[model samples]
Target: MKVAYWPGCVSRGFTPELHGSMALVGPRLDLEMVELNRANCCGAGVIAEHNQELVDTLNARTFALAQQTGASMMNICSTCQGAQSECQQRLDADDAYREHINTHLEPEGLRYEKGGDWSNKNLLWLLVEEIGLDKLRERVVRPLDGLRVAPFYGCYIVRPTGRLGYDRFPHRDKYLEHVIETVGGTAVEYAGSHKCCGFPVITMAKATSLRQAGRHLADAIDADADCLVTPCPLCHLNLDLQQPDAAKYVERDLNIPVLHLPQMLGLAFGLDPKELGMDKHVVKTRDVQRKVAELAAA
Candidate 1:
């Protein structure tokens, strides 16, 4: 089972280990991962908000690359997966956008396939469906030992409502929570778990973004969560890097450490701090690492 891996821009820079974690665990789950050697940015929020042509082109090019591999594509970022899946949906429905994109690529002899939803899978969907909670259970060498996590969805993972295409999952925070529990960690529910992280507003108005991020941070911190974990890179960026600023601006100590979903899952499997790249993150997950070590020692 080989699949094309799309790391997107943020994961390439900010959450580098996510791909590494996937590489480490992919084979264990019977997946052979092949990264798109020529992949570029998924246009983040640019093409979607600004140029429809480029959005079509960006997603089409990625599908073209995946076709080059003769394999389906799986993405690590919630934003990228959402973008690609959205583009796929649009291409699947509208013939005009599809032909326009394929024409742009025709100079290079590339084209989007007809009558096909470009094969794309989000990690959340893959983990729940492909990995199976039962299989995830057998691999838990290290239990989270009661460190509570606030299951933060923050929009992208479960959007357009019905695209996830699975049973009774209802496209909610419960999917990631279920996976988290299999690794022995409790997914704490809170008020702001489904709210936006103010990622789009961050660039235009810093205050609005900080206010929104702080509100979410306060909820997780107020819940006494040891960490805030989510699958979106933008959410990780906003919640982790912006919290200190948001805290001061909001006049409260959020002091909450943020973890990428993969980072937390890696820890739950006893992968250790170095292997998980905990020290390199903006939040410096070292304290969480120390807590785990101390608890393990006792």
Candidate 2:
């Protein structure tokens, strides 16, 4: 199962372990993860608001690189997945836009044709749809038996409607839960699971963003969850990096640890939490690690 892997901007610099854990866990799942050398930021789904053309050209080139690999483009970040997938869909449907994009690509010795034999696939979809839950369960040597996980989908991953193929029913909210249970963790449903982590509004309205992230954490805490797990890097930033701010706004101590989906998966695959970058989190993960240790004993 070879695919061109794009960690996007945030995961490369902010949460590198997301990709690192994937690299470690890929072979266990027979996943051949190939990095995209020519890929740039998928505009983080923000540049489109200011310059749609730049976003389109930027993503078209990324798809072009994935095309070279003769495999689908696999994205770790939800915003990157949505942005690039949206661009691919537009390029395939719009001829004039495709010509315009190709004109820009021509200078760099790259060409994009409509209805090309390439596509973008989200990493979560690759796991659930392609890899299968039973297969993933088989690799879980360290089952998260006693841990209670709150699955946060954030926004853009299963949203904005009518874009990605994974937007179908039964998966929009349940995919994360399925992955959690596959690793032997109990999935807790809270108000935060389907809510936005408030990354998009972080720059423009910092306070509002913090409050939103705060509410999500509060919900998870209220539900007595052990940790929060998400596939989106921005969500992890809000839920983990900005946790102090979220605590301030919510007027409570929101101390729950947040983990990248891969980090949780890595732990279940029997990799050390430190190796998966768990110790690097703003919120302490030692308790969660200890809990896993306790589960091992039980």
Index of the highest-TM-score prediction: 2
TM values, all candidates: 0.92, 0.95
Q: Write the per-residue lDDT of candidate 1 for residues 1-298, one digit (tens) a residue.
A: 6888877777777667666676666665677888887877777666788987788787898888888787778887878877776777777778887887899888877777855444677666778866677887787777887878887775766776665443446644578788778878878877888788888788899898888889988888788888878888788888887878888767897778888777777776777767776776666676688877875676
Q: How far is candidate 1 from the true structure (C-alpha RMSD, Å)?
A: 2.2
Off by over 4 Å in 1: 114-118, 162-169
- Residue 82 in model 2: lDDT: 76
CA RMSD per model (angstroms): 2.2, 1.5
* Best candidate, lDDT: 2
Candidate 2 regions with alpha-carbon error over 4 angstroms: 113-117, 166-170
Task: For model 1, state the Cα shift of residue 271 in Å.
Answer: 1.0
Clashing pairs in 2: none
Give the per-residue Cα lDDT of candidate 2 at 119: 59
